[model samples]
Target: MVQLLNSYISLVIERVTMTDEQLVKECVSGSQSAQKKFYDLFAKKMMGVCLRYTNNYEEAQDVLQDGFIKVFNKLPDFESKGSLEGWVRRIMVNTALDAYRKAKKYQKDVDVDSVGFMLDSKDFIVESINADDLLKIIRAIPEGYRVVFNMFAIEGYSHKEIAEQLGVTESTSKSQYSRAKKMLRKILIEKNFVEESERGH
Candidate 1:
């Protein structure tokens, strides 16, 4: 009986929290209350999302604000066929990409025909690192590598897409992502955050 009552309470709480679709409908209708609630729901997550693509706090804040502006302006065109969160996420990503392009951050020319190199497999051992520590290490990566890494590894963009977006060759995108992974692994190893093979076992 106690377990059943607990489950019932959980369902009640879930029902009280508005779905993303419900929020979108309200936002599109220009409901101030809904807008406030939507901001409260996604602001922090969107900030973190922006931070991953930017070099510093100020740039991140700018991206976040700009992304939100785009979201509000484009909300009416959103088709409800898919996840509203996903639609908003794409906008945030494109906003970040636009910021990077406008900043002219990609300056290196890469030889696409160059041989592809492999990263050390040991880096995958970093499964033990906490989310916060992982984020810190990722943030420490240089801007070029950081952007590619976040897009490829976290945001699920392809090398071709990354290359096109950053105005670099596909080889450059792949190389930067590999370098980012190697650097992150090195940082984790130096911090003694990840156990050596024997210790990990």
Candidate 2:
């Protein structure tokens, strides 16, 4: 009877839907099951964020684990003023930046590439190269250019915010971003990954 009652209780508990707030509260209260649920909810998206900031799959996995540790430790202090996923995403981004800084990945001086922009970025977007190809090209760029491009163009961070996070001057951030775009444009064009169009634009 006791075992049957316990199983029944567990079944009832499992059927209950949890909002993010409730999941967070349960996690904060030391519920192992709740913590598992919390990790499952955000792990994939967080891993994508980690991958963008890392050079390869293994390093990205390392950053993902480190980011989750910080997330779990600091979660209790998470105020409810903003979306939980946004808060967690910010934590992951900061964790990646910290790892990058520890590895001394910051560039002291990156001159903008002088490649002329023969292709509009908008034109490249409509091509058939696919997302994985795009990611590969982004990863092939130098770390300084890659990081600035990811921050400013993809993450919607202003050059000023990227400058602060990267410990570079705003002009440096802008220069790197411009260099990343021009260099990426040149590579994609040379690779024939983009649609054929007149180059005079």
Candidate 3:
């Protein structure tokens, strides 16, 4: 009985795998049904990516739609070198950066020399805060700083890559990241999420 159940599960998995590949092939061939299936599969995750790059809900939705359009248009180039989802994610990231550049919203120049020192160990107190609250504070940061911070800290982009993508200098990226950290620390401190330590009077 156990063997029969295991065989049944394995067959179900195999059928699902075949269906996914068929869907992709049909989508590449421009089948509307497959396209709908692809959208249903990825829209939620893609929307989360869009939200991270945008300030407001409307802007996020616009970016999401734009990203999906790009994905569909570029589906022919997707040769399965990597996971289709990762390719889609890269497209979304690039689209968000492009939107940022076109809007002239991010800082063009950064004063590297003016970068401040890192906060002290005692000052890094937001570690105790909940993840949701921390995300709220991050979202409150200015668009330029927030994008840089998300790319570098959360999304793991290097300074050089960020600078190249945003059309700024590496030092500028570093400075923005530093400024973001300092601002986050201040915000968290003000919110009493981090306790103040006593120093010598």
Candidate 4:
């Protein structure tokens, strides 16, 4: 009877859907249950964002936890100027970038222009690949390439904006993005996702 009563209460709690504003208010009001619910709400999606920026699941998990901490701490300041999810996503991305910068792996700069990459988006039909496959390919690339690619291609940030964020020149951002595309196409071809002829040579 005790176990059944606990399950019933859990179900009732799960069924109680609060608006973002309501949840934020509760969280700000120092409610542990509300805070847990808020974390549960955005954790998965934010984890995906963190994963795109990190090398592996473990690193991503760290970023996710850090990001959520920031989110909850800053929740009182969130003025509902945008969707809560969008706000959370921005925090996750920034947190991932912070982790990247702290790791100092981005110190090695590759002269991507020397590789003579064709700077065109018409090269690969990325839509042919599923999200999981694409994510795997993204993660397989070098960290610098991965960061530039995620910022420029996936996140819709312009090269100039990406350069500002990553503390590199615009040319470097462009070169890295081009190199990322070339690497992605090469990987796709190697994986048989695209035909040899369609390798965008």
Predicted model with the maximum TM-score? 2
Candidate 1: pairs in clash = none
Clash number by candidate, in order: 0, 0, 0, 0
Each model's TM-score, in the order given? 0.79, 0.83, 0.75, 0.82
* RMSD to truth, every model: 6.0, 3.8, 5.0, 4.6
Per-residue lDDT of candidate 4, residues 73-177 (tens digit): 899999987899999988898899999999985743665544432424654445678867778988988898999989887777898888888888999887778
- Report the C-alpha lDDT of model 1 over 1-201, residue by residue, as the tens digit: 999999999997875786777788889899998898888778888888888888888998999899999999998888788977778888898999899888866746333223222335455446677766767788886777788988998788999999988878999898788767666655666787753442221
Q: Which tens-of-lDDT digit does each residue in 1-201 have in candidate 3?
A: 999999999997864675545667889888887799799889988877778788777988999899999998888877776788888888898898888788875774444334333444455444777755766787887779888987887677999999988878899898888787767666766787654342211
* Per-candidate local distance difference test: 0.78, 0.82, 0.77, 0.82
Which stretches in model 4 have alpha-carbon errors above 4 Å? 1-17, 105-108, 111-128
Model 2 off-target regions past 4 Å?
1-16, 108-114, 118-124, 196-200
Positional deviation of 48 in candidate 2, in angstroms?
Answer: 1.4
Clashing pairs in 4: none
Tell me how far the alpha carbon of residue 136 in candidate 3 is from the true structure, in angstroms, after superposition: 2.7
Rank by lDDT (best first): 4, 2, 1, 3
After TM-score superposition, the amount by which residue 141's alpha carbon in candidate 1 deviates from its true location, in angstroms, is 1.1
Error of 4 at 146 (Å): 0.2
**Cα misplacement distance, residue 86 of candidate 1 (Å):** 1.7
Candidate number that wins on lDDT, 1 or 3: 1
Error of 3 at 65 (Å): 0.2
